[model samples]
Target: MDRLHARYPFLDAARAAVDEADVDLAALVRSGGPAVDRGVGRVESAIETGDVGEPRRVRAELLSYPVARVVVSLVDDPRLTDAYARAEARTAHERFVDDVEGSTPVSLPEGIDLGRLLAEFELAAAVDVGVSVGVDEDRCTVDVGPYLRLASGLEGEEWRLVARDLDGGRVPVEREELYVLLREAVRERVLAGLPLSVPEPVAETLEPEVERVARSLSDYELPRSVTAELTPAAFPPCVEALIERARSGEELPDRSAFSLVAFLAGAGADPETTAAVTGLDPEAVAYRHERLAGENGADYPSPSCAVMQAYGDCVPVEKRDERCERVDHPLNYYATAVEEVSRSEP
Candidate 1:
């Protein structure tokens, strides 16, 4: 149970809700009517005994909002964390939008409200909405508005548009729809707990609002202190390169990102310091550190050059020498570098 709580942070809240009877699990599922009534009874029994298996089955049968409400009552269950998180994030986003619109002076870019644009980006990132933008010569095409349909597993007409200069005469109907779709995509991903990347043009336009939303969320916190001796110069070339790329706001591959986090934790960097060093979200750094320390156990070594290369992060120059090949891990390189520097100095 402790391990489960560590693995799923939301479980604590769910479990508490169930124990306190904060929500009526039976009535919540009853909205699904007679066909799901039996499943609801089983879910209530499971919740009372902390038997996740039965409730999970009920969850599968009652896939609609009614079941989600019941599942949400059991805060300790991971079966519906995604649904719960999405709902909470959406509500937060709505409040954020209202705050932004009510206080700030709104501007319009290409007939779209700036506040709305920022909201869209926030939602997109939180929800993992998928939108692709492609460039062909002067025109940029964006695929839009498939997130809901995709989530429902329904086939829908493809929505797309070619980007054009809005100031250059009448905008095509598809282009207008494209703008709306673009916002929707951005909003979805913002809420989806996924890394977000936007075109430079779009980023520049949304800079202020983006910063505001991110600051408001404060998703990551700074480290109080760095435990290890700060030695950037002694770091392996691969690690140094990753740090630089992260600072420059490049979205690292998932493998590389996790490897960096694990290495930082193993090297005795606290979560906040790790976040600063890697330019990752603070909360994310903390979570990764916790996972590495708890589940993976301490002493996880930094990945070798070969593994780095597999993640598209290997610096070719670092591998030019046979010495680099002999090094078992990035930490070894750092150790060797520090030793050589110490020997040469005194």
Candidate 2:
């Protein structure tokens, strides 16, 4: 137990709080029902056992209470922890948005209360709203790219911006509505597996910027073209769909080419035919097949057939083997090709 205490700093404080009754632990329960005294028994049970396991579990349960809710329950609620979490999220998003906008903190229409919008969503722990805006030179477009973290399961951040006609405000064109639109505008450039900025260790750090963009967008009331220039954001359309479905516990289609190929092979697709369709070399196709076979507990049909199945391309294994013989290792050729291609590209 002492060893566990030394490892986890929070356990000691949590134990002290529970022992002294200094904290109104009941106030931390989920808001769905009548006051449930689950914590008191749980804490007592853990302390009686004197086993390290109980304390660890108890600490986790206590911390699971949303920081905001915890503050509300406390008498002299210092919203320090909750406020810091929100600030961290906002700063990360701002850094991302700034990178997208060429470092010009993209401002929104005057009177669009971004701070309030974020507060509303933060308190709710999730946000789903709409904004309409038009394009201009300075605030030409409001980028939602920074808000990706919020949209996923972490804090449930999502928005749809529909463009309204200036005259009649009809024929709404939602900025994030179309697949191809997001693919070309946001996905292709930014968010293509790029790492977050220094301040953004986690998704929460970008929350503020996301809120700013969301609120500022409500005023423009016109559909504007926004750019997606980040690496991880390279596939905004696909990423968004995946995120939404994942949040709802739904399965999305396999989009990665490699994963798709693996899926088809596992489902019992013929190797030779699959290779031709996928344009992969025969041996490569068989390698994937072998992997799937191992996972499925099936015998490899044939090494040659497996090769053909794995490659999923027109190239024969015989020719590939000849090519492989020239290189010290099979990967050497691939590495050299990658380098050459990178160097040759603009």
lDDT of 2 at 141: 25
Per-candidate TM-score against the hidden true structure: 0.32, 0.18
lDDT of 2 by residue, 1-346 (tens): 2322222222233345445645443343433221122222221222222111222243444443222122222211122212222332333233334433344543422211333333322411222223324342222122233233222112101122222232232222232322112222222122222222222222243244334333432221111111111122221222223234444544423223334344334334555744654555567656555444332212211112223234442234443534244332212233333445558779
Top lDDT: which candidate number? 1
**TM-score for model 1?**
0.32
**In candidate 1, what are the lDDT values of residues 65-157, reduced to their tens digit?**
233233333222332332233433333334334433456633322222333443434433322212222423223232223433222211112
